[model samples]
Target: MNNTALLKPETARDEVYAAPLKDLNPAQPALFQANTMFSIFERLRAEDPVHYTPESDFGAFWSVTKYKDIMAVDTNHEVFSSEGGITIGDQPMEEGPLPMFIAMDPPKHDIQRKTVTPAVSPMNLARLEPLIRERAGKILDGLPIGEEFDWVDKVSMELTAMTLATLFGIPQEDRRKLTYWSDVVTAAPGQGLIDTLDQKFEIFVEYHAYFTELWNQRVNADPQPDLISMLAHGEATRNMEPREYFGNVVLLTVGGNDTTRNTISGSVLALNQNPDQYKKLRENPDLIPSMVSETIRWQTPLAHMRRRALQDIELGGKQIKKGDKVVMWYVSGNRDDEVIENPNDYIIDRPRVRNHLSFGFGIHRCVGNRLAELQLKVIWEEILKRFPTVEVAGEPKRSYSTFVRGYERLPVIIPSRL
Candidate 1:
């Protein structure tokens, strides 16, 4: 079999999509940094949905690339545990693991997650809707017409950061710090965010100190609806270890901030790139909900979640041994052609729009998903009401980590209203 000849043309045509299995290592952060991950994911889904990489920077691991296989691993928490950590790289052993509920299994995960669930519940969303709309209106109306700006900074970050502050009942002035900490938590060295472990630790130390002050303030006061108060007063979470407290804070902050902000940025990029679909959206603003769902599917904000195998399991004809690290590549699964028709196209009005892997399928699914959707829907609705179009000024600057499929800057200019 002349593997090179067959693979070479496809590799040249779509460089990321046709690499030979021997040369394929999906865990390499460089693939993500280069934004060529779809090619690797496409090749894997077609050839080997459950493939093993013998060696890589993050050590040996299995990559689960198809839609159903990812769902199986994600839902069967009993077989594939999250206790090892959620990202491909294990948490720094020298410092020890941070005890966030997202990385815990069974009873502990259930109880702790329940504490913060109310903050994003249907009733709470109703409380936050008017506030979100007001903020979205202000942010969009404030953008300089016909002048270019980083949409990520002016709109995406500001909105999500403000909402995060509201959820925590923190001062509006300090909201940007939550965005900073979330970026630092996912960033690796040379990603141009944090350059060294010492630097990372310093930022986290400050984060711990700041949030500890808030926790202290909340614990002594009468109960409130904010997340800090929920944790301070909840039966499962009160009296938490300092690291555990820090871990949960990171979880909520990153979960709330990154997913929404990135999607907001990504939706603009997706819509602009697909002008026909953008035209559809403009012609019918009622497609906002479907567009919101499609943007999440297309962006897949958090690329993959790592789970450690609790017992040997057979999946997609591959044997995964106990303790082996298995990554459910949601970004890949969301693009699987077997499940999603026209998987690569950013069609806003796709039928069964919600049937995608942006949010995991089981108990560990993103709890704040509805809130993220609400923020996006409100912002887009506001944008359409004002500007005829939001033009992309130039190429987007994407985030550097494999785990966070997001943009760092999206330059755009909104022409004066018609």
Candidate 2:
């Protein structure tokens, strides 16, 4: 529990079992920041699949860690509503609750989601693929080979920021602003991005102003292929309230941002940790698609999705009351042994690699799920063509949040590019 001496996975394994299941608080951002929460999740999955804590940093919430149980809660949108919010600790916006589709229920969720769906549609992503590959190649090629560099910042953040900007039809030059705003939205106090809630709200004010200007510009011009134009002209979303529009834009921005960025970082670390998988991938570059899916499952980038129970329901022999916070730990569920064979092992050729819960299930499943995979696929393909291996030069600094399970900095070296 000492912050001075960070918890190693081995130590975390023993530490988690030492505490009583009821006393364990799975929502601690420190546990995630240290990357030692998996042992805690493993213990919970075996002992208490539907575990609850009376009090914690994010207030009392339920942890649904099993694959089947998570699927139940995720799929039954009617029973477990996202209306409360997606993250366990839902921070209220200064402007009040942003009415985004990912957090809305029923007919309303469908309407708002439909409006922006085209921005990331298959047709749209197909058009974007060449650009993603070009950007990925450029990003990778620009890396200082044989020298240690932060992959999360250099490759992950930069590439995702560009893609996010392209998706929104914003200037690629201003992409880092998108990256900064996305990080601020999810960062908590002392996380290194921003310190206080007030700072976060202030950043959003600027973010809202910029996006609102884009909306105004697009609303007047003929409809364009960009997301802002889509929202500016969509039948249901055109007359949206300011907060409502901001909510949807944030949803798309962060949704497009986090999942791909983190997973890209994770894939490198995973391949290094599992050298056999790396060998397999190197020998058969055709496995890049499978590797991407496996990495998504292995990383489970967005750790958990939270929902407020709409009605009382029995799950895993425990009663979940209406209004209770229910969290589907996708990170844990992906490692559940019941559904996945050798769940903890990172196998690039694992069968049904896409069967994992990283991208929630049912109505609220990640809208940009395919786009995320496509980005990873293209990036990895470019990586394979260039580097023999991206060696992890040092330990990674994991993201400091329970919600955004990703790396902040990953020191890696591309010894020599081919």
Candidate 3:
């Protein structure tokens, strides 16, 4: 019942963490810069691959920096539970508890994941490729020529929202709401347009109302081939509680919005920054698959995922007690020198590109990874077909939160109709 007890230990750890934070500067204006947190990650990965930071805004957490450590923890899910929650810091929600598959450990996690796996299978995604491509084409067709535009708003957000709209069978007009709800839900403590606590609840209330309507409609309507229909009609899903259903919707909405949106915006930014790689991609469009993987790696959009130690464990030479919070720094691990060669450079044809931890690793890896790639590849191909040049017209800005790395605004100029 005492929050102060929690505060004392964390404050002590802060003194230790801050000492090193002062010596090392890993912040990069382009790659990572909003806060000096990432700089600390880069420092620890170099000095101590598996380091513990006693103090953080989220309380004390162990920062897992190496690629191997992250994979080891992720694969050994039995010892490290996802059920305590997947967030590193304290969550803002006052709801009793949120139901998300990402927050459940095995058994429950396995069962929950199975409920929606059918909808995202490789075969299902292949069947939807043509539809994704058609949507990508329409998105690119609407962009203005020779004038600077915010690519994040116009292209990246639109592509992701449209693809999700198709997947959920959400009407076109309501698609933007997906982006809104996702921002409010995931908006780290002080980020985004609406910063007040009450404002955050209002947004969630609206999303709940919308999803409630959709759920009621889907329950009565003929079974369609979309995700909503799949969840509604599936026998497994019938066992889910109302909160669980709400959790799935929230997960799907956030998953659909942030990851894909960043990949698209990050891809264009990477291409512009590395013209040589962009030239290679433009010439050999076949390399788009490798490029997509590289872009995910280079961007490392979803920054970190938190895991709770279910039992006492020794990881990377450190002993972790049960209930210890472990934060996997995907952004830092993606650039681990040991796992990735010349990790800082953007290599379009890097052979081991698929080895990156962008989609994460092990059982809880991103469920919509294949779909995200399909959408990115389609959008890139369409852009190449229509425009020969799409260059940054101004400096791009990044989101403030450490969780999701993405461009809040990316100014770009495209030559007249290629």
Clashing pairs in 2: none
Give me the runs in candidate 2 sitting further than 4 Å from their true place: 1-8
Error of 3 at 249 (Å): 0.6
Best of the candidates, TM-score: 2
Off by over 4 Å in 3: 1-38
TM-scores for the candidates: 0.96, 0.97, 0.91
The per-model lDDT (C-alpha) reads 0.89, 0.88, 0.80
- State model 2's lDDT: 0.88
TM-score of 2: 0.97
Sort order, lDDT high to low? 1, 2, 3
Cα lDDT for residue 385, model 3? Answer: 95
- Please name the candidate that would achieve the greatest lDDT relative to the true structure: 1
Q: Give each prediction's root-mean-square deviation over alpha carbons.
A: 2.8, 1.7, 5.3
Over 182-294, each residue of candidate 2 has an lDDT whose tens digit, in order, gives 88888886668787888888899899999999999999999998899999999988998988898888888889898899999999999999999899999999999999999
For 229-298, candidate 3 gives per-residue lDDT tens digits of 7778777785578777888899898898899998899999899999999999989999999999999998
Clash totals, every prediction: 1, 0, 1
What TM-score should be assigned to candidate 3?
A: 0.91
